[model samples]
Target: MRYTLLGVFCVFLIFNASQTLAVDTFCQETKTLIVFGNGIMNSEPEADRSKNRLQELLQATLTPDEFKRLEFAIAYNQSYGLLRDLYESLKQKLGADNVVTSFWRWLGGRDILPDAVQQEFLRVAASFDFSTRVGTQDLSIHLALYRSKTLEGKKIVVVSHSQGNFFVNAAYVALHSGTDPLTTNSFGVVSVANPASFVAGSGPYTTLFEDGVIAAIRAATVPGIQPPLIWNLTNILSGARTSDWKGHGFLDEYTAAGSRSVNKILPDVIATMNGLQQPPQTVQDGIITATLTWGAQPDVDLHAYEPNSTHVYYAHLQGISGRLDLDDVTSFGPEHYFVSCSKLETGTYRIGVNYYSGSGPETAQIQILAGSSVRNYTVPLPSARGSSGDQSPIPVASITVTGDTTNGYKFDIVGGL
Candidate 1:
């Protein structure tokens, strides 16, 4: 069975092998990439709640034109509320001192939990496919954002909250390590209620002195973990209150209009977008985009067979209309594809992958953004020597476009891959 982990975002763009997607030279010269990395949430409802709040804040803050120029996405990481409740129960049963000690140990890079507790944690972790799962999912999501439509010619400002800071930081490192120096200038990060010592992407992180979680982490003096800079009285006065009891809610204490964090974030985002050199080319595709990222194994290929029987892949970079913007023959790919907005066709387009060659088994992830809908598929390529033909590659998904270029195309996920 094939399952999906959702990496939500609005739109991403990509150029050629440089791994940068672009917009047509004639499109908006500059656009904003507001990729939100949400904090720990028991459920998606809590996660989405913050995104909605942030959206509201952005809508209210930016001018009508500014808001329209924005592309938003949520890099959601799973947090089990039940596990938190379980830990509390365990704390009560085993004594808070022991639970706290075990937690600090885990934080300090050791897992010395009692066997029963460790087993439970591992069981739950497996159920969610945490380590092997979340790591790749986060990569795909942010890479999608990196190649998103907003990033075509401008920088991307990641506004990450709480645990999201950790994810964003890791992603920033991974992307920077892989891309060119110019790509580095195309990315920025803003951290809030951060618990990590280091900020990613030239960060000026935001954390309240009154924030209990960060305070506790700081009190522990965990070697590598430190609280973000303390906010001054003037800043605190504007954001002392919070919707979350912890004073860490993304909206209530951080991004709400006039809050110090928002004051810091908005200007930083604007500065990032404004302080960069444009890419060599820019092309907009509000129509469709598919991004592929895989594991350590090398030479995974992304194929997009267009409705007009045009096949786009490593062998052939451009089809009748779609373009394979990035092709990676080495390990850990982010091969991308998209149909130019101006030449969208009306018919079914199939997406597939081939484990062209590799050291060992690899898991391939493909994220598709068609119109406003985003879908993610994870296919485990157990072996190598895969062939490329109309049906040789393992099918991932299919997208059907209705309407026409004259009226604007409507993209829909037709059915199973």
Candidate 2:
């Protein structure tokens, strides 16, 4: 009787342990957020640091209950030559029980080549297994994992930076086509400095080149795979030429174009995730117009023109100032010209002029025209007499237009220095 009782007790213990495991293994209403780095994912130190910082930021943004229900996944070191390491690390962090963290490598077998060589290699390699494995194959694997019993029914958020975004887009396409199992669930994607280029133009992936990728991401329609909501965050300090490989590995070293603040970017990301905001949209159809003028200057003959010869003037428009070309404007005139009221779409704009003098004070009247309206402005030419003679170029500025969309107005002209 004693031996039988002991055996029964052992069985009871085993049953209880299995039950506990089962409980921990299932999360019915959990949300999964996958944060990915581009090239940095391959660098251990950078990846770990970025992950820690992002986690802290997320903690601050999410409520206690929401945070608890959220599962975080970071993919690093997988795109380079470190595919296996990236896979193992994600598995360990997510656990063999309840989570599915997809690990993909877009730049796998070609890691041995230098940057210059890889560029050429990727063009041809796009057809090879190495490219297929990381780019499309790995994504397929991830889909299968997501469809497995362990991860079914969970909400997924894919946060990828740089090249990783490319992989995400490809995965999205594959899933939409019913080529992958995990594509059956709804997923949200947040892409930062996504190398896809359509976000800002000019990158490893040109804007035109990435349009197809965007279309692919948009095509996803699996029952389980939620239509992806893509959020693109561009670096305002760095111009559009930044490399995905470089930016992901050295974020601190590079700044975003247009001087966008980093602190603001994170908050914007959180707000977007919480459904509190939408990405900024282009306010105006493509159109830009500006006016030029010179106030009265002390009459000096053609000789006077010589004194002011060193002085130069130009206009600059910030933000979406339309497709107006600088060369078009520069090629047109008697050096100075006037633009009549022409329709301009809503966006940011600015204008300015410079002055120089051989010795006398001169002034000129300036008028700016955009979309059937003229804003009169003035700038005084300084006398060559004082230190003010060397004043740098003055930037005339204006308020950003918000909702104007009338089109095809002519820019009429006036004046020269």
Candidate 3:
């Protein structure tokens, strides 16, 4: 009887181990990704140089496992460049089976011009052959290629720089807006330094344009399909204006100008994708909390880096005096920001605040009426301001709070409590 029991136990353990392995394999298998290169992908005189640079950059940013799952597609500008050379280079790096290179010789041959200047060229070129236009035709061809038997059951990721964003946007509109949803063309889009204005009320296809292309890409979602999370990286150091249409045309110019380092940008791209794969967090309370520890200073003043800047700047500028006041607390410590609700609920919430220093140990009190009692805490600031009459008190840094409600509650702060 003892011998028989041992055998059964061994069998059960083996079965359970196999089940765990199977789950892991399924997750790894589902991570299929494709990378698309923009016009500059092949601009280098030597195909090998361009291909190797891109491959090395990708290798550094992605894990070996992630690198294995990625495929590359190079879109070559037709006129002065040789599409065949670019294709050959990409094929060598990504393997012929995994790379798809598309070239429009007539369009690529035309003189490089600004978007407005190239309008006539685009009309002439797009009219010639449906497959010639990179935005519409080329994208359709690529989608078809993606759906081919070789790529079945694979997830899609489009990485486009500069003008490539335009082409991909056009393709997204074409595939998504119509009556018949192009389920086969499902994929996430990553726009690097794209300058296109995403403002609403811009044009006719604006709704479709924003929804299918920019917004969907950002959220990583498509209608009737799981949204592929999208990432956009803008470089502040590159000196390239994020809004300039001309600046986007030449990738080399932007890179040379130092808008952002390639090292910094590439890592972020890979990290964003990895983050999406992690299981999402569930918020039990309407409240969400974040804490920042002060190292060098006990008190720090938070302010908008620039006056009249949009809300987005609140996160961008570091070490600026922008005051984020919670209720009446005029000055608070630098370490903690919190949001609380009367009851627990399921929803999303955001907390924004600016920390400033006036005097004493830099303490603040926060009260949420939903729950009983006020929460008191000391936030460390860097150091006290020098005793000078000329120096101004720290400016107001803004903090924004957004969340769904399980119950309604009012929030206020008592500064220097």
Candidate 4:
């Protein structure tokens, strides 16, 4: 009889524990979530379209009310306005309406144009208003939306990726000195795969992230101006999908040429569109990190061209969401670029180096950091045949992945052209 009573008590205890350990469901917060996409998102012809695409990316993870609060419609400055001019230029030259369905690579018009035309195109692009280009129009629209009555009283959270984060930084600086009507508004920010570190350099078309999302955090904490929350999910390019959400990864339409069928972003990123919980706080060790170093005198640029044809280089800092972390023009120095195998779409990533300036022959170093292994390669650039200014076609390193990163990733590397 005593044994029967003890068994009943044990069963009761197990049931109680199980009931208390139930999963916590996501709840909707009374705030508005806004997304500031990299170059391409803002360029979408319409706001409703971008908003819907974001919802689809997050549909698997977000509740209906949570989805309703999202607003990709907020107006912000659009970078690559130069691309508009270039598109028109190319449209006129090619006399083809389909100059390129997407502008991710701008193709640098490499395949179509003569060497001199490409040079001219580069010159025009590099000369555009880089100094304050981000702060002017895109940021202005973003601030206006914040101050608008529509978003009043609602918490405002910004999820900025790549170049989008640059606009966020400018907004902080604008609010640093004076007072804005929306000063007390609940504001939060999250920056993913910040290209600011690579772009910040004095090199042409380079941007500065001011060393990661700390810039956003510090900006939020300024006296008289503090957002309710600020979290930076740095370097999430692990070459795999960023979350468990279906259809999540870097870019769904990563194929670089022609019209892309979708604009779905990684679902892990979509979750953080409102808050900081979903993305891991720091970069893990297993991700791939590449460092490129060359003598300071030559304007040697590291170009990592995605299998999709989007090239990551000085001219284009954010290519298919990968980063060119460092670019050196003044000295023989170490420049680094990194992306998680998770963020790397399954394809061949062709890494190459260009002799931008300095006439002499130079040896380039490639350092790959993965798991517990570190491999380094020394590549020599062929002597400049003539007075070639910036277009030296030398391949340095290549990394390819053939399978799903989650199930098990198969990555192969080739070090030379």
Which numbered prediction scores highest in TM-score against the true structure?
1
- Span of ten consecutive residues with least summed lDDT in model 4: 1-10
Q: How far is 386's C-alpha from truth in model 4 (Å)?
A: 74
Candidate 3 C-alpha lDDT tens digits along 1-417 = 011221121112123332332110000122344445454323534323333445566776666766765544444333323345445544554556544422232223333333432333323222222123445434544433333212234545555553455565665566455433345434555554442433111211101111222342334322454332232344444454333222232233223233453544455446444443322111111132222222222334322221233221223332122222212222222223223222222222222223333444442222221122222233333345533311243322222222223112222322331
Q: Which stretches of candidate 3 lie over 4 Å from their true place?
A: 1-31, 40-52, 77-135, 149-151, 177-186, 199-264, 275-417
Give the poorly placed runs of model 2, Cα more than 4 Å off.
1-29, 76-134, 148-151, 179-185, 198-261, 268-272, 275-417
Write the number of the candidate with greater lDDT, choosing between 1 and 2.
Answer: 1
**Residues 313-365, candidate 4, lDDT per residue (tens digit)?**
77677766367655666655445555543355667777766666667787776
Error of 1 at 312 (Å): 3.9
Per-residue lDDT value at 80 in model 1:
46
Model 4, position 199: C-alpha lDDT score:
20
Ranking by lDDT: 1, 4, 2, 3
Candidate 2 at 255: error in angstroms? 11
Residue 112: error of model 1 in Å?
A: 36
lDDT score at residue 226, model 3, on the 0-100 scale? 31
What are the per-residue Cα lDDT tens digits for candidate 1 across 303-388?
A: 88898898788878878878887788887677888775556677899999988887788998788887767887878988886564
Task: Let me know the TM-score candidate 2 reaches against the reference structure.
Answer: 0.34
RMSD, one per candidate, in order: 11.0, 28.0, 24.2, 26.6
Q: Candidates ranked by TM-score, best first? A: 1, 4, 2, 3
